[model samples]
Each structure stands twice: as structure tokens, then as C-alpha cells.
Target: MVNGPAGRPARSLTQTLPDGVRRTTLPSGLRVITEAIPTTRSAALGVWVGIGSRDEAPAMSGASHFLEHLLFKGTHKRTALQISAEIEAVGGETNAFTTKEYTCYYARVLDSDLPLAVDVLVDAVADSILDPADVETERGVILEEIAMHEDEPGDEVHDVFAEAIYGNHPLGRLISGTPESVTPMTRTQINNFYRKRYKAPEIVIAAAGNLDHATVVRLVRKALAGTPLDTGAAGPAQPRAGDKRVRVQKPHTVVLHRDTEQAHIVLGGVGLSRYDDRRFALGVLNNILGGGMSSRLFQEIREKRGLAYSVYSYAAQYADSGLFGVYAGCAPGKAGEVLDLIRQELERVASSGITAEELVRGKGMVKGSYVLGLEDTGSRMSRLAKSELLHGHLMSVDELLGRVDAVTIADVEKVAGDLLAHRHSLAVVGPFDEGAFPPG
Candidate 1:
């Protein structure tokens, strides 16, 4: 048996995993996790790295995302065009994305083409040349991307909300660095960051659909051979440290003026971490409030009052911090009334808790979405990676559904009171000055 995080014994190789799922840890400390779905013709694979925007220093802001773009530029053995041509030759697609806490490069291809997918992806990630010319090219592209983001206020307000909560913390910074930060960044700096941070122990390779776990492991090992990732024996990296509390700024209002047709507002505050036992309860609460058309926020804000065309509630959880927010897009003139209505509903839920009937519907919504989301290979592959990389273990679909089913009305009330009753920070974007919305 191998040691797991915190020096505990992990599941032995002989131990039974969830149905059709298997895992192996290489001597280099990289993990390969897979789920076999015999009925599908296509397979999905992802290389998940533990590092993300939150891992970068203020000066290195957006390094993770910048590196993501650079990796596709070329590698030691394959030209950029050759890389795309090889994948496209097989009618496959590939892409990568950066999140606050991790980054993933993935591809979906026919099961027979998984070997090609594995080789090309691993080569790009492990042996990228980081050409100086490519860096300058992507820098300009990223700057233009940042400029374009400002044109969409509905999307920009969420980032503004995060900033309102975390202030200058790394978590608050944009995943794509600002023009000021990207323009001056050097290729040498990026190359150094990539070599130092992308270690074997902090990476997980996951694949799903119409494949064998053993074969996937073999492919990964072959693909990694002689690359920077092929290191001497080690154990998988310990999960991110979650014992320390993440400090958040005091609740306040932050507004960005934009001459837009609609106002976008996000109101919320600090919430339970992903590790909290109360997260299941919080999930149920979120669904009951605004998960679907039948949700309370949709009914009250849009159906009953016709105050907004779009309204919803969401919770974002990280290793040691989280936030729960309600979002609405409406006419600029109706911003104040919409905000008040959101506040009133939050107060009511926190005070009286959800009823038994609401609790049942909420649980159903949570379970349904979770199951329906996994119907595709990409989602299944992601689930395997997230469980291993983020949560430290794989939880079966049944176990997850059970957790949601176990939430009691009192549990919902407890999480509601703990999260919603706190002072909230507001972020608004559209036709308004900074002081348009006063602090609560």
C-alpha cells in the first residue's frame, strides 16, 4: 500500500475501487486514474496540475494561464502545426483551461486514438520549448482577450465581486493577468516558473470511456519517459494545506460604471470551505433558492415581480475559503428594487429556514443535476481527476447522492443562518458611479 496525504495509508492496489474505476501511482509520483465505460466509442483524457492562479505571486499574476497558452505553441519534438495536425488527423479535439486552484489540458478522441492523444498532450506539457516569439504573440492575444472581457459587464461583475471579498489577495486577481502585468513579463521568468512549479507529484492524469486502466497507465508511462516528469521515486504530493483560515475583507460595495443596457449585481459574503461537513446542506440550499426555473429566486424575482430577466444563486468552494452569491441581470433603473428583493428573501430563509417540502425538492434537484452531468465522458474524466486531485479520494455517485439526501431541514437552516445572515458585499456593473449603491 502507498501512503496517502498526511501519512495515512491509501487504498492498496488490490483494494476494490468504485465500479469500473481504477488507479495507479507511478514511481515518479504521478497518478493515473481511469473509469471504463464499455458502451462508448470515444474517450476523454485530462492532465490536471495542482497549481493555479492562487499559487502565483502578485508579480507573477496570470503566469499559470500564460503558461497554458505557451505550451500549445510547440515542443522540442513537435512543431505547433504538427501537434494540431496530428490530433486533427484523427478527428479529435484538444483544449486547456485555467481555474483559481488548478489547470487542465484535455482531449476527446475515439477510444482507438487515445494513445495519440496521450502522447501529444504529455509531450506538449512536459517538453514545451516556450519560444520567446510565441510568448510575445500570446501576450498580445491575452491583452486583447482582457480588453474584450470588459465589453461584457455580466461576466465582469463576478470578478469584481471576488475582489470585493478578497481585496488584493491572489484569489482576487484575474486569472488572465492585466495588460500592465503581461506586457512586461519575460520569457525567462515564465520558463523558470514552469520548471520549478510543475512537479510530477502535483500532477494527475485521468481518462474515461472504452479503455482499460492498465493500458492507460502504460501509455502515460511511455509518454512520460525521458521527459522532465520522469523523475526518481517519490510519493504523490500532499493536498493543499487547508488548516489555515483565509482572511476576507470586510463587507462593502464595489461598483464599476459602464454604459450598458442592463445592470449586473452580485451580493454575498464568506461561506463554508469545500471541506466543511455543512457543504452538502449548502448545496441543497442553493438549489432551492435559484438552481432552476422552479427555484425560489427565479419565482420571486422574475416570475412574481418581473424585476429581472435572469436571476440565480451559487456557491464557490475552495480549499480553505468559499463564497455564496446571488446574481441578477435587470434594467439599470430596477437595480435598487432587485437588490432589496434579494436581501429580503435571504433574510427570510435565514430566519425561518426552508420548509420540509422545499427540502425534498431541493435534495432532488441536487441529486438530479449531479447524475445528469456525468452522462458524458468529459464529465466522468473530470470527476475522477477532481476527486483525486482536489478532494483526495473518489466518492461514488451513490455516496454523493446519499450525502445530498441526508440533508435535513434543520441542516439547511443551520447553513443558511451561518452563511446568509452575515454582512454581504455587493458588486455592480452598469451605468453607475462607485457610490451608487451604499454599504448595507
Candidate 2:
């Protein structure tokens, strides 16, 4: 059971073994969460703001991503070069990224240097001046980024698939908007966005590794002193829902011809949302189907048949909805055969489901990967931040492992049928856009 936030001096959310996490909300509505890891020498800290690409409107399509780049260009307190240089001088790593539901500015440094990290990350996220000249310069950089996204077949097909399956919803659009959308995004619009969305209540400050909860709280307080984020009254925004819940549409098989010799294709269907309890079972089923080197898809498509050099399956979980799909990059001539085989595999899984042996192997694979991924301070820090920002709760590693182990063959079979029996979508990028994408 978890304690409520009302009266406890510290909001102790979840604790496991040698580590425990605590949360405290400042008067300005800022939520600070920290995990004390006494053994590690490094710490990771991030400021997570709840606005992301999905929250943008038609005109401000790429504003969130744009701000991600522009914010580092310069803040009122430090120039862009000085910002990176200062962190580099301390042997720390700093970076930021924008996602569909939130954006995070993070830093990794020696535990002794935690103050520098907090100071810099806070300045970058909260004090960016949004200079006009810097905006114009980054515009070209963003344009090139958009151009770069166009050239990568493997990456572009997934976005095309999203547009096909999710329709015109913001979730379906590229995180980096088109050149047209980004080129004209002015400083005023972006500045206003930063002011409106980057509020205290909508943000979370999280730290992990060799840190004191009270010390982290003090550092964040000292860093934000007079900023609006130091004081606000709204509760955290509700997890993104609505259209995301009922947003998927008819299946689509879209093809965009390119001069590339290899064809990149994504075969996917609407998947269970982050809130779905079936996710644990689905994780095991995905492992057997295409998650690793020993999985069915990689074995059949790449090893046994040599149809593709790279083949794997993945699941993208979002707040209210998600996507499950397989990606195969193969020679243009093998596109048709690859698609056929993929469909056959889906049909087979949807019918008979995985075997008992597969169930054990899948569970082992998932649990092993889960445990191994958290071995680093950075990964642990990310885990804590994401749990707070996205899920709004923490599940201890043991509890998670237990859930993974509890999934039976029946659970996997039911989820396999439930997700795979639906109308799946396909997106292909090849030299034969005219003839490559086949009818459903």
C-alpha cells in the first residue's frame, strides 16, 4: 500500500531492497522526486515538463521539438557554448529530448557535482531567452533534421504507418514537423508556448544515485528561487486521454517510393494502452513472436530464410493508446515475400498461440532484460523520472518481475488473439511505391 500526499513529511511512494523513493511538492506546485542510491558514484537529474508534440495544434506542429533545440541556444544566464562547455568542464553529460506526451532535460554527472547539474538543467529548461537570431540559425538546423528524417527509409516508414493507421491526429504526425511547419515557427509563438506550458504544476524534477532527498529538494528550491515554477497551485495535468483512446481508424497499406535499394516496411496493429493490465501478458507474447535474436520473426525471416538482414518486433506504449509492430528491412525484390511471411506469422500466432516452452523462454527473456537494463545510475534515474512523469506511480522491480512471471500461456494466448486478430496496417518505403504496396 502507498501513503497519501496530504500529511506525510515525505511522500514515500515505493521502496525496494536497498533503494527507496520519496516525493515532495513545493508551494509553487512543483513535484520533486528522488531516489537515494548510496553505492553509486554518479547521479542523474531531469526536469520533466508535461507538454509534448501531441499537445501541439496544427500551426504549432513542431513547436515542442523546436523549443528542445532552441532552449540550448542560450539562456538569460549563460550562452549556448558556455552551457555545454561548463558541463563538459565538470565531466558531465547534458541533453534534452521531446516526446509525444512530455519533454525532459537531463544531466549525468559525478555525485559530487550534482549542484552544477541541477543549476544547468534548470537554467536550460526555465530561463531560455529564446533569442530571435538564435531561432533563425536553429531553423536551418531543424530543416536539415527534417531532411535527414526523409532520407532514412527504416525510420520514415514507421511515421508513414502512424499516419495511415492513426489518421490525421497529432499522434500520427512526425515529432519533427515538415519543413513548411518548422521554417515559419517564429520566436513569439514558441516563447508564448514556453511560458504557458512549462509551469511548475506541469513539471517534475527527479534525481537518483548517491543523493539525499532533502538535499535535492533544497538544490531545486535554490535553483528556481524567484521563478514561477517555484510557486503555482494546479495539480499535475491528467494523463493524456480522449482522442488517444479512440483515435485509431481503418487499416492502411501505404507506399512511398524512393530510390533506395532496400525496402523498409512496418506491419502493425492498434495495441493495448499503457493502462491496460494485459500488457504484462502481451510483453511475453511479443518476446516469442519477434523481440530477440531467438524469436520467431528473427529466426524465420533473417536466420532460416535469409530474407532480411534485420528483422524484429516492438511495442510503443503511450498514455492512452499504443502500437505493436514488426520492422523488416530487406531488398526491394523481397518486399512482397517478406510481407506475405509476416502476415502468415501473425495469423499463426493469432490461431494457435505460443507453446509452453515458449512461455518459459519468453518470461526469462523479459525478466532478464528488465533486470539488466537497470544496472546503471542513468537507467535507474530514467526509470524513476518516467514512472513519475508518465505513469504517475512506481512499481518496484520485484513486483514487476512477479507480474512477468505470473503470466500463463493462457494469458499470452488470449492477448495474442486479441491484438493480432485485428485489422493490421502496413507501410512500405521502396523503389516501387507504384507497384510495391499490395492491397489488403
Which candidate leads the pack in lDDT?
1
Model 1 CA deviation exceeding 4 Å by range: 1-16
Q: For candidate 1, write residues 314-382 as lDDT tens digits.
A: 999999999899999999999999999899989999997888899999999999999999999999999
lDDT of each: 0.91, 0.84
Clashes of 1: 0
Model 1 TM-score (2 dp): 0.97
**What lDDT score is found at residue 162 in candidate 1?**
94
Error of 2 at 355 (Å): 0.5
Cα error of candidate 1 at position 408, Å: 0.0
Q: Lowest lDDT 10-mer window, candidate 1?
A: 7-16
Model 1, residue 324: C-alpha shift (Å): 0.5
Per-residue C-alpha lDDT of model 2 across residues 303-366, encoded as one tens digit per residue: 9999999888888888778889989999988988988898889889999888899999999999
